[model samples]
Structures are given as C-alpha cells and as structure tokens.
Target chain A: MARLTLDALRTILVACAGEDDGVDLSGDILDTTFEDLGYDSLALMESAARIEREFGIALDDDDVNEALTPRLLLDLVNGSEVRAA
Target chain B: MSTQSSTAAGASGRRVVVTGLGVTAPGGIGTEHYWKALLTGENGISELSRFDASRYPSRLAGQIDDFEASDHLPGRLLPQTDVSTRYALVAADWALADAGVGPDAGFEDYDLGVVTSTAQGGFDFTHREFHKLWSQGPEYVSVYESFAWFYAVNTGQISIRNTMRGPSAALVGEQAGGLDAIGHACRTVRRGTRLVLTGGVDSALDPWGYASQLAGGLVSTVADPERAYLPFDAEASGHVPGEGGAVLIVEDADSARERGVERIYGEIAGYAATFDPAPGSGRPPALGRAAELALAQAGLTPADVSVVFADGAGAPDLDRAEAEAIGRLFGPHGVPVTAPKALTGRLCAGGGPTDLVAALLALRDQVIPATGRTARVPDAYRLDLVTGQPREAALSTALVLARGRHGFNSAIVLTTHRP
Candidate 1:
C-alpha cells in the first residue's frame, strides 16, 4: 500500500472539518501542529474516523491525540496500515 | 398551591419585556420576512424536500427551503452542530444584535442566559450516526454526536457562543414546551437575571424523525399544500409538521431602560401551564384553566384580552376542545381568535414561541394577521375566527395558547408596555 501523503491528509482534513479562513493548507504544513493549523481535537477525531474508514486502517485514540502535526499523523496512519498488512 | 403563594411566585411585580425577536420560520428566515408572509397569508407548507418522503404516510411539510448554514455560521461549527442548532445560533445572533447587545454592550457574562425547548434532539445528526453504527460499526461514528444529538445542545451552544453563563435550561413538552421555556425565563428575569435568550427552534424532518411524527397519528396525510393542515376549518383533519421557530431577547424592563433600549415589544405579563385530566375520565380539559390562571396572574380579566392565539391542533377532537375552551372563557365568538401557524404547520417545540412572536408583532402593528387558509370554521365552534385579510383593531393584549401531544397545555398573556 502507498504511504499517506500530506496532500491526501490535507484533503481528508478539509473534508472532515472545514478549513479556517486565511489558513493556507497547501503550504509547507506537515510539521505544523494542528492547533497552529487551526484544527481542534474534535476536527482531528473526525479526520481520524474518516481515514480509518477510507484507508482500512485502525487508529488508537492515544496515537491520534499524540500525533500533533500532519507529519506525525501521516506516519502513525501509514505505520498502522503496514502493521495491518 | 394556594393562590397567594402561586401569585407571589409567578408574578413578582418585576416587569420582563421582549426587546428583540429573531425568527426562522417555514415561509421566511427573518422576523420581517416572516411577518410579511403571515400578513399576506402565504402558505409555506409544501411537498417535503429535505428527503424523499414518497414512502411516508405524510408527504408534506413546512420546510425552510433556502437556509444555507455556511452563509450564517462559521466554518468550524459546521461539523460539530446540526441543522436545528444552526438555526438557533443564527436566530440568537439576530436577536442579540437586534437587542443592541454587541460585544461592546458591556453585559456581564453571568447576567445573560439561554432557555430553549425541543421535542426531538438533532434527529438528522443522530440518524446519520445510527446509520454508520448499523453499516460500518460503532467505531466509524463521529465524536461530534456526543453533544450534537442532545436536546439541550441549542442552549449550550448559544450560551458558549455569547458567554451567557447565567441560569440556563432546556424544556421538552412537545409544542407546549416552547411557551413553558419562555414562562420559565420570565421567572428567571424576575429573580434578578438581566436578560435571557428564550424561545424554541426545531427541525426533525429526517426519515427517522418523520417516521416518529407519523406514528403519533396527528399529521395531515393530505397531498395538496392548499388543502392540507387547515386548523379550525369544518373539514380540519390533521396538522402538517414543520421546521424552524423563533428566539427572543427577554430582559428586565429596568435593565432595558437603563441600557437605553429603544424598542420594547411588550411585557411578559403572565404565564401558566396545566395538564389535562386522563382521557375518558369525564373531567374537562385544563386548557381553559391555564388561560384563566395566566390572566389572573396578570391581574386582568378575560374581557381585557383583545386577541387569542389559539393552539389550532387541526385534529377534530383537539380543535373542538380548544374551541370550547376559548368559547367558554371569552364567551361565544366574543373575542378575535387567530392561528397564523396555519401558514407554517405545527412546529412541535417551535410552534408556541413562533406564535408568541406573531402575537407580539400583532401588538406592535395593532392588526391581527388572518388565520391562513382556514375559512370554513364550523358554526358550532363559535370562534370569531379572523380570516381572508388582516383585521384592523385596537389591540392591547394578546393570549397565546399551546398544547403538546399528551395534554400539556400552556398559555401566556402579553400586554402592551405601560410607561
């Protein structure tokens, strides 16, 4: 399976929770914390549920919470996919 | 309860008045538009468009067609709230703005509160979550469902948005609960709260909600919008369920005057609620008692009330009971009675507050909007039903009545503010 990319994650974030005005998601944002990127815990939880359903991956609540940045979340999701395979 | 104790508790001599109104009804979105629609007798009931209701027994509804939530609410709130909450938040925004309570208005957070009513919670949000539970397992459900499906979510969200940390509650007595919530808010204001955002807004038109409404056996199954849901007409069958309602900024008269509030809609003179005796017990229904108690609390008589906003249940037995109550209280065809909800079907928890708004508007304009599309009132009912056109009258006081499904009756008396 292909790794989860920042672009795919951005799409999921926008779909699960709406983007804040003036917050550019297309920039170099992988390392930016979700709080700085204007996404809250509820938004992240919604994104995680959507990702789990779409990518056939299981994500623990702790892992989702600990993945503060898009890079960390993508790594956690891809790691879960590899382990499931 | 003794009359003295009840009077002391219910009417503390502290005046509470409605300063601003925000409405999102079937025919219109704002108070002005809704009032215009009501005066012109526009029918908002139509074929249900929220979903395909072809399979349901009742296929028509009073649905708000052009409400785009994204235009009124912020982006982040779009995911966490349901349509009903969206309506309420927007209405609260309009009401607060109308009341001149901007961020710079300098009201203490604890001085403002919110009280609302809802018969069903966010049924659409719950239905979506339940579908995911049945299809993809419970893990797929969104976390937002925790608060979004609650009946009190409207009050919670409004309180958080506006930082109204004072006394807050959510009532649920079906249609009558709307009036009960405002009645409680009146008590809150009398108890020293400066202002309370009180009213009701409801939307349960989803397939699951529709099924439950139909199960009640009171919805009009008529297909045509013109002929369906005729309240008080001789051929009245049943009411069409509707979405949306109204919210008002109820404030202490002294506080409003101190704040330099320019317009006071009317005073919340009196309010009362009663439960009917058990069906077939041979005791009379208690709707008239509720009205009498409200008037007595206001220190007024039945003859002083200029207009009566009837419940207009649309079903034969319920309409007959309401008509007989009105006839007995005000004498046969003695007082002008109207049901502007004939335009927007029964709104459950939303109906009573919306009717209250209509009554206040009538008091403001000094004219009674006609009962929409109900012309052939039975002679036996003996209701001086206002029809055909808005009637010109010297309106001073209005009584709004509402009844929930299982005999919950409530009445509110509004008198023009004196001094």
Candidate 2:
C-alpha cells in the first residue's frame, strides 16, 4: 500500500477547510499543532472525514482528535489497513 | 380615539435611524443595483437552476444567479457557512463599510451588535449533511452542522465575524421575522447600544428546502415567471418562493450624527407586531391593528404616510386580508401601495427587510417602484396598486407590512430623517 505523503495531507487540509493567510503550510509544518496552524477542531474533523474517504480508512473519533499534527495524522493514516466495503 | 401603544413606545425619546444598507436579493447584489432594478421594474423570478428541480411541481424561484460566494467571502468561511449565511456575512460587511464603521472606526466591539433573522436556517447545508448521514454513515457528516443548520446561525456568525459583543438576538417569525429583527435592534439601540446590524437573508432552493416550501401549499405552481406570482390581482393564486434579503445599519440617531455619517436613509420611527386570533374565532386579522398602532407610535395619522409597501402574499385569501387592512387604514384607494415582491417572489424571512429597504429608498428618491407585472387588479380590493411603471411621488413617510404563516403580523413606519 502507498503511504500518505505530506504533500497529500496538505492538499486534503486546504481542500477540506481553507488555509490561513498568516500560516505557511509549504515549509516544515509536520510538528506544528493544528491550533497554531489556524485550523480549529472542527476543521480537523472535516479534514479527517475527507482523508478517511480518500484513504479508505475508518479512524476512531478520539484517535483523530489526539492526532493534532501533520506527522501524527500521516502516520495514523498510513498505518491503518483499508477497510473492506 | 388614540391607539394603544405597546412597549415599543418606551424608547420614543431615543430616535433610531438607518445609516447604511446592504442587499443580496434575486435581481441585484448591492443596494445600487437593487434600487436600479426596482426602478426599471425588472423581475428576478426564473426556473430554479440550483438543482434538478424538474421533479418538483413548482420549479420557479427568485434565484440570485450572479452571487458567486467565493468573490465576497474568504475561503475558510466558505466551508463553515451555507449559502444563506454567506449572503448575510457579505451584506454585513457591505453595510458596515457603507456606515464607515470598520476596525479602525473608533467604536468598541461592545458597542456594535448583530440581530438577524432566518426562517429555515441553512437548509442547503443541513440537507447535504443528512444525505451523508443516510448514505455514508454518521461519521462522514461535517462537524459544522452542529450550528450551521440552526436558524440563529446568521446572527451568531455575523456577531462572531464582526466581534459584536453588544446586545444581540435572532428571531424566527417566518416572513415577519425580518422586520421583527429590525424592531428589536431599534430597541437595543434605544437602550444605549451604538449600532446594530439588522435584517434577514434566506435561501432554501435545494431539494429538501424546496420540498418544505411546497408543503406549505402557498407557492404558485405556474411555470411562467410573469404570471406565477400576482399579488392583489383577481387571478392571484399563490406566491413563488424566492431567496435572499437585506441588512441595514440601525444606529442611534444621535450617535450616527456624532460619527459624522452623511447619508441617513431614514428614521425607524415606529414598529409593532401582533398575533392573529385562532381560526374560526369570528375575529378579524390583526394586520390593521398592527399598522394603526405603529402609526400611532410615530404620532402620525394615516394621511401622513405617502406610500405603503404591502406584504402582498399573492394568495387569494391572504391578498384579500392584506387589501382589507390597507383599505381600513388608508380608506378606499387612499394611498399608493406597491409590492415589488411580485418580481422577486416571496423571500420567506428575507421578504420583510427587503420591503423595508424599498420603503426607505422610496422615501429618499421620492419614487415608488411598481408591483412588477401584477396588472389584473380587482376593483373590489380597493388598492391604489402601483403597476407597470414606477410612480414618482412627493414621498416622505412609508409604511411596510409583513405577515408570517402562523399568525404573525408586523408593521413598521419609516419617515424622512429631517421630517
């Protein structure tokens, strides 16, 4: 299976909830928290829903909430097995 | 005999005036465009293009074809809000800019407030979420649905965006809710708030929203745009559903003058709302009572009003009731009456504020826009209905009326600021 790359995560984040004008997502943003990145909890939830649909993964709500950074979210997505429909 | 005034009379000493207006209606996006459309007697009702409305019986709507939300709002707000709320946010921005009250405008966050109305909330947003819940499971639904579909979402979003921490509220009287919102904001200003962003904006043209409107049984089924909605006419059947409305900067007159605001639209001189008696109660509709009380609150007689912006529900019984109320107050064909909604259809909660905007502009320009294409007026109705062409008159004061489905009736009187 292909891994979820940082570029793919950036695309999902911008597509789900727009990017903040002040925040630069192009640089090293893997360790930065979503709160500092200007994306609120609701925005993260929306991004998670979109990522789940695209990656064919079912993420636990609490687990998604705990994954607050891009690095963590990428690891979580790449580690999960594609659920059978 | 003097009319009995409601609690609205307590704020009689503190005058409230409209300083700025922002509109996103069917025919136009801004106040200038809207006014020009009204003057030219342009109609905005057309076949619904939001979705595949072919399956519905009543497919025509007063849709805003040119409003590209991306042009007016930021991308972050795009995902958070629905179409109706987007309209309101843009309208509020325009109104605040028009009033010259921005971040640097000296007014504190606590002095500015927002009081808006919406009948169905964000139907488009809610419908999409519901589809996900049924098809892709509950986890797929967006978290914004928690408040996005709420009727008070407009007020909340407007207040939050502008950081308006002053007295604010949200009303839901269906069509009458728009005027009710303005009236409440006037009261808030009288209590010493500096300014209030008031009025309403609503859009529910999606399949679910359209179905809800059809369930009301008040929508006209005629496919022709011109003949679909005719108010005060013998052939009046029902109204065509439409979307969008107006938002106004209602400020304390003294505060507005202190701020050096030059263009004052008009003073919100009087306002009153009343509930109708139960059906089959052998009692009359309270629309006339509401009008009389509003005029009395303004210390004006029926003759003082130069023109009337009527509700014009465009249904037989509703039209007759509104006409009778006008006749009782202004006598038979005593004052010029117009319902520009004939062009835009009934905009639900947005309808009343839109009419109020028309009244204020008419008072400013001394012209009454025609009731677009509603020509076959029944003589028995006794309304001096303005049709075909805009009527130029020496207008000073204008009376606006609105009635909701479940027995809500509201009346507001706007007079020239200098007068």
Candidate 3:
C-alpha cells in the first residue's frame, strides 16, 4: 500500500507542470483541471503515465480522467473509483 | 515587400557557410541513414510501442526504435543523464566528425560554439522521478532530479561535454526551437566562430510525455499507421508525435576555404524569425516573412530558388495556412516543394534541422524527395506537393521554414558555395 501524501503529490505536480512553483500545492491537487492548475494536457498525461509505470498497476482512463482534485487523484490512485455524477 | 529578405541579409553580415552535417532522426540514427531514409520515404510514424497506449485517444506516434543508448554513452554516465542529453551528445560527435574536426583537428585554442534547440527537454526522467516520489518517500527522490529534466539542461550538457567555450545558448521555443537553433548558430558564426555544432532532439516516447502531447490535440492518434502522418495531404488527420535530432557544423566562408573543405554542403545564407503580431489573418504571413527575409538576406530572389523544405506541421488550420502562404509567396508551379518528414513524423525542435538536412542534401545532389504518404492535397492547398518518388532537379538555392508550436516562425535560406 502506498502513502498518498502531499510530498508525493508535489513531486507529481512539479513533473506534470514541467516546473515546481505554480500550483497551490499547500492546499489541494484536485481543485483544478490541468488548465486551471497551470498544467496542460501534455503535462497531466505525463504525470499519469509515470504514476502508472511507477506503481506497476494498470490505471484505466476513467481513473485518470475522473480525478480532478488533489485528494481525488490520490483517492483514485489507491483504487477507489471516482463516483460518477 | 515581395522580396524574401531575412533579418540577417539586411543586417550586413559576413557570409555564413556550412562545413559539416550530422543527424540522429526518424530517417535514421545517423546522418547517412537520416538522409537515405528520407529519400526512400521511410515512415517513422507507427503504433505506440514504447508504452501500452491502447486506451489513449491517439495510438500513433513517430518513435525512434532500436535506439540503444549504451552505444552512445559510455558505462558510467548512462545512469545519470536523461535520454535527451544522450541523443544530443551522439549527434554532436557526428557533426564534429563530418566537419573534419575530430579530437585531433588541431585547434585547441580556437573559439568554437555550440547551440541546441529543444521543446520538451527531459520528460522521461522527470516522469520517472515523479513516479519514484509517488512510490517511495521524499528521500527516494533523487536530488539531482530537479536539474535532470529542466528545459535548459540539454544545451548545458552538450556544451560541457564538447568543451565549447564560445556562444552557447538554448532557445526554449515550442517546436520551432529546432530551426531557430540553426538560425541562432548561423548568426553566431556570422558574428565569428570557427565552427558551431547546432540542431535539436526531442523524445516524448515515455507514457507521461506521450499523454501530455496527446492531450494537447497536436498528435495524430489515428490507429491506422499509414494515415497517421500525412502532411499536406487531404487525409492528413493530425501529426504523429516522435523524436528527432540533427547537427550542423556552421562556419565562416573564409575559414572553411582555409581548411580546404571540399564543395560546401550549403551556406547559411539568410535567416528571419517573426512573431504573429495578432492571431487573425493579420497574424502576418510570419512564416512567409521568415522565408522572404531569409531569401533576401542571402541576396537571392524566389526566382533564384529551386526547392523549399516546409514545416509540414500537419494540423489542418496550420497546414492550409502554410500552403496558402507558400503558393502566395513562391507562386505554385515554379519552386519545387518537398517534405520527407511525413515518414519521420514531426520532431518538434528537431524537425527543422531534419528537414534542413534533406534540403542541404538536395542542394548537393539536386534531387527533391517527395512528401511520403500524402496521397491527396486539400482543395485549398494549391501548391504542387512532391508526391511519391523523388523529383530530379538541379537545386542551387533552397529555403527551410520552422514555426514554434505556440507562435514564433523562422526561415533560413541555403545556397551552394557562393563564389
């Protein structure tokens, strides 16, 4: 079981954004879409891909696509499927 | 002005000449293969093999297969550097050799320059590091990871490895960084330098990088491999993403002549880069501006040119716009046009140099290879697209264009040894 902590989120955030200083990391990861968080679609995809490769688990598109908040992405990371609206 | 006068031509500069050529692209890992593949139109675009891209929106990409990194990097350094740096180092070695300036090339004290352009610098490493951090604790995050994938790292890596002390800079342009690298190198040489190793390489093969590109809507994710990267063709759905590398040995005319270098590949005759003043039609035929400026800088006219190396970005809006620009500037029939990149996929910052290599070789061999796989041109695109096999023609002057993914546009004019 992996610990879904802020530090872990920060690293992923920095990598996706292609830099470290933009997002409101001290608060939430899922509070925004890639665009709102200054993360483009490319950066988000990169972040998701690396997460999959690192965790050695097959993350489905819904798992990545549905997670919008930092808490939500972390929740999604742990295998909790996003609740469809 | 109808005249294609690049800023360099108007600046009153010393004649710039190319002394060496090197490449590590989809065409081939090295210059020879890079050129040969383009002539034969080998398709670099294919289904995603680097990662399991089954679920992604687009499965197609231009990936460089069989790139055995160990072949390029010695034992110790392989683990530390990113793939981007590895590609750049290998390309620089090839360019220096092609220029006839090896470790024993005799000028230890001479001032040399090195400039490389890149869009996504080290996505692979950054992606991996992020994964590690997620999988392990903060301690597991390699401290060096901070600098490993940054935008400016590759240029520094090449400069340090080559011991190049003169004029070293990197352009953080979108895709145009590749051709812009050449323009920068040309200007650096004109300002004075013995030789410059310049070009660009980009690898978005990693899943993270791939996703990033896919999300942008820039990549042609079509499942069918053949239809993935048809630039200038009506069937051109979208561009295939991939890696590309090219290195040029730029030098002054007098210096090259002094070394007794044989007939020059082509001179860095003119270069012009302009930003889109506004997004509308007034976006200024910025690319055309780049071309005209380049031609004018070379002291040549469109009538003097035999062929053109297009950007061929493949996005419909950009594609039609580019075609209209070319037909408007060069008049459809007169100047033969070709873009062998359809097979190699667009290399982003690396695309320009890859296209320039084809253009430079065309000047040397006088054959313009056709655009591969582009079976049909859009109705709006009226230019005579070089289709299927190569076009046999004597080329004395050539034009190469590159545009930043965001907005910057550049044009470089090449000419045979100007007597």
Per-candidate TM-scores read 0.94, 0.95, 0.80
Worst 10 residues of 1 chain B by lDDT: B1-10
Error of 3 at B45 (Å): 1.5
Candidate 1 has a TM-score of: 0.94
Residue-level lDDT of model 1, residues B82-166, one tens digit each, is 8889989999999999999977887999999899998888998899989999998998787899899898999999998889999
Pull out the clashing pairs in model 1: none
Span of ten consecutive residues with least summed lDDT in model 3 chain B: B1-10
Model 2 Cα lDDT, one tens digit per residue, B1-419: 22434333364467899999999999998988988998987899999998998989899999999989888877778888999999999989898899998888789989998999999899999999999999989877888999999989999999988899998999999999999999999989989899999999899999999999999999988889989999988888799999999999999888889889999999988899999999999999999999998887777889889999999999999999999999999999999999998988888889999999999999988999999889989988999999989999999889999999989999999989872
- Clashes within 3 Å, all models in order: 0, 0, 18
From the highest TM-score down, the ranking of the candidates is 2, 1, 3
Q: Kindly list the per-residue Cα lDDT of model 3 for residues A41-65, writing each as its tens digit.
A: 4455557666765665555676677
Q: What lDDT tens digits, residue by residue, belong to model 2 across residues A52-76?
A: 8887888888888899899998989
Misplaced by over 4 Å in model 2 are A53-68, A75-85, B1-12
* Candidate 3 deviant stretches above 4 angstroms: A1-85, B1-13, B280-285
Complex DockQ per candidate: 0.66, 0.59, 0.02
